[model samples]
Structure formats: structure tokens, C-alpha cells
Target: MPYLSPADIRSKTFRRKRQGYDPGQVNEFLLIIADALAGRLRLNPDHIRTVRFAAVPNGYDPLSVDGVLHLLEFQVRNGIVPPTGLNSGEDLRARKLPRSGTGYDRAEVDAFIARAAANLDGRGSMTSTEVRNTRFSTTSGLLGKGYQVQAVDTLLDDLEQELRFRGR
Candidate 1:
């Protein structure tokens, strides 16, 4: 069997012991080992996962698959998706709309964009629907009092800019 690199050993070693080496010292050593290994074998620390955001037809908005994936990951991290089968469409819909809430705030929208950006790191474009759905769902909640469904749609043009969506 090939010998493990020092970085590999360090990863395991770092996990143990109550009085481990100072973090700075340990990190310094790891960097040196990383450099040495970098010359011996190609390591792609910068490699990114490829994701494709599908297109949305004329007039609807929803999260792209990538955007959805990001939202799902965030939801999972926050215990919002539960432990299993979280990606099911029904489940996602449930999370998108709480039983009783005014709706997503500016912060929520910002968070959604940030999550999508992370999930689609190097991906080109995003589905128009994906962006719309996020807005629609959120707006639906925000416009709860004396808010007409049709009236909510009237704000789409303005909201689109905030969402950074490119209309198809």
C-alpha cells in the first residue's frame, strides 16, 4: 500500500488529544506538508462542482435545480428539511411556505441569493422560474394583510431586480 501523506496523518492526529499542538503550529506544519505533496501529486483544492441552471419559459419563476439544491442544503443544516427524503417536491414546497407567516423578509431574500450563488459557484445562468418562485412565495407571505393575489404580481417587475434574475 502507498504511504499516506503527512497531511493525511495530520488530519487524523489533529482529531485526537486534549492538549493538541497550537492551532497555528499545526496549521503551519500542514501548509508545509501540503506544499511538498503539491509537487508530488496534483491536488485540486480549487476544483469546483459543475451545476446547470435550467431555463424558465416566458412568465413564471421558481428556483433553479441548483438554487433548489442550495436551499435544500441550507434547510437541512437548519433542521428545516428533517432527516430523510427532504428533496421531495412536496417537502420543499412545505418549507417554502410556512403555515402562518407574513413571508420572507429582505434578509431572507438575500440569504436565498447567497445560497444560490454558493450552490451555483461556477454555473452559467439560472432559471427565471427559480428566481420567480422564490419571490412569489415570499411576496405571498409579505403581502398577507389586504394583499390581493393579482396585486402581488404587479410588483414582479420591481422584485425581479432585487432577485438579480435575468428574464427569459
Candidate 2:
């Protein structure tokens, strides 16, 4: 959704999760965003950057979606259109996995996010080119289930696609 525009925000359909965002509240906010986009006005970019939410039962972590919104706002303000997911960059959201869970290893996943951020932000040596070809092995630990391999691989594929799009 980082690629969503103001108009896109207006037209986009958000699914109602049984326990996702408060539909009313999120929809209201989207309207504000769309209006601001239409008016060429910058709203609370700083607020969006720093905002956090209290998790509700069944409500998705608003941050997951907000992060994309923040990115979109930043790009719009800077007058740059971030290419679609297929274009450029290796950015990802990191999630912590329990030491004993059916999730990717917390350490490895975090490390990957760090690397992706660095590469995308140009703070590391790995070029976007390298990221496109990079691959990771599933983790091995004395205890706990690692993040599902398929899930992590899928994410990597997405990250790679982003990088490839950017590289192109």
C-alpha cells in the first residue's frame, strides 16, 4: 500500500476483518488523507510517523498499515512516486518471533530487516543489485520452531521484487 495515492486511498476498499481496525475510525482517517492529498496539503506527517495504538482484541496492529501510509506520505511530500512493489528498494517490516513458536527465528528475521533497511537506505555495502540475488537459509535452533519457511521465502521474494523494480 506504500504505492497508494490520495485518489487510491479514496477508491481503495478495505476489507472488514472480524477483529481488524475500527472500521469507522480508519475510514474517517482515510477521508482526511484523501482530502489532504486532493488539496496538496500535508497533514500530520510527524504524527503519523510517531503514532502507536493500543491493540484491541482481534484488531490488527494499526502500525502495520500505518507504516505504509507514512511511507506514502513521505514520498508524496517529496514529490517522488515510489515505484510499485516491483520496482526498487528492499524495505520490510520486522516482526519478533517467540523463541518457541511456529514462526521465523526472531534473530534471523530481524537481521534480514536490518540488512534490507540498510541496503535500501544506502547505509550498507550491499547494493540493491545484490539484494535482488540474495537468499537466506532457514534457521536452526536448539529449541523453538522457526518462522515458517514458506512465509519467510514469500517475504523475501517480495523484497527481491521490490529491489528488482527499483533496479530496473
Candidate 3:
């Protein structure tokens, strides 16, 4: 495999989609990763692994960004910075996402998390694709109750990885 340089990462671009990852967020994240790869920033593998971005209209394609992330993770884990690119829910029952005023509906997110935990423990069936496709109603207004969107999305990303690892 060809090695990826920090410059390559910095210059990478993704196709835009109607509904995808926020472009500014993705670009900022790429800069961070590039900096880390270039020894100008400090970021552990887990930090790269768990990073999340908001979804928005007219955003960068998610699959493209995710592919880059996977490569970056590989590079990070193998000490291949500038060369390569890249869960467990045990205690999922005890996991608590921070609440937000405008975010995913708490009830819906909790139920999904429960289901994900059960699936991880071999007590239920849930596919990575399902996790990837999962969506929840958004709570609106300052007083609205919900789970923090980033936290929930991050957890779901972990769960999806676990399921994929297990070939579920």
C-alpha cells in the first residue's frame, strides 16, 4: 500500500452530498489529523477513532470521510504516521451521554443504546448497517430534553464498529 503523507491528508477532498457530514467540521478535523501526522499535534488512536462530526445539508460525503478516518486510524495504531491510514459496549448499560437542549430525543437514544448493548452481549440482533442508518427525533428549543447529539453519535459509531468486528 502507498503511504499517505500529512500533505495528502490535508489536500484530500470529498464529494458533497445532500445530507452528509458538515464540511467545515470535517475540514477542521482533517487539519488536526494532518497536524498530528506531521508531529505538530498530539492525538491518540482512540481520539482519532472516536471523533465525530455533525451531519448537515450540503456536506461532505460521509463514506469518503469515514474511509479517510479508517486509514488514519491504521496509520496511528501502527506507528505509520504520514504513511498509513485506519468497541466495546461492555458497561454500555452504565454509559450515560451528556444531555443537551437541542439534540436527539432521550427516550429514543436510550432505547437504541439498550438494543445495541443487548446485541453486543449476544442477546439481540442488530447490524452495523442498522446502527449506521439509525436516526432519532430531534429535541428543539432551549428547554427541550435530549441526549447530546455528538455523544450519542459517537457511541453509535463505536457500536457499529463492534458489530462489524464481530461480523454481525
Choose the strongest candidate by lDDT.
3
Give per-model CA RMSD.
20.1, 12.3, 12.7
lDDT of 1 by residue, 1-168 (tens): 223332232342333233333444434434443333323223232221132223323311222222323432343233231122222223322333222235445455445545544433434354434545655344445333223333333233223322232232
Pairs with backbone N, CA or C atoms under 3 Å apart (clashes), candidate 3: 70-86, 71-85, 71-86, 72-85, 72-86, 74-86
In order of lDDT, best first, we have 3, 2, 1
Candidate 1 lDDT for residue 154: 24
For candidate 3, write residues 25-118 as lDDT tens digits: 8889887876566554578988878989999998999988888888888886775743121133466766678988999998898888877777
Off by over 4 Å in 3: 1-90, 142-144
Model 2 segments more than 4 A misplaced = 14-19, 52-63, 80-168
Could you arrange the candidates by TM-score from highest to lowest?
3, 2, 1
lDDT of 3: 0.74
Pairs that collide in candidate 2 are 19-58, 86-165, 87-165, 87-166, 88-165, 88-166, 103-146, 103-147, 104-147
What are the Cα lDDT values of the candidates?
0.34, 0.53, 0.74
Pairs of colliding residues, candidate 1 = 61-129, 61-133, 62-129, 62-130, 62-133, 63-130, 102-141
CA-RMSD of model 1: 20.1
Per-residue lDDT of model 2, residues 1-168, tens digit only: 446544456544544344566645655666666545433346765655654444445654465566656765675466443333322234355433234445556566667677676666666555434543555555555456476655565555455445544552
Give the top-scoring candidate (TM-score): 3
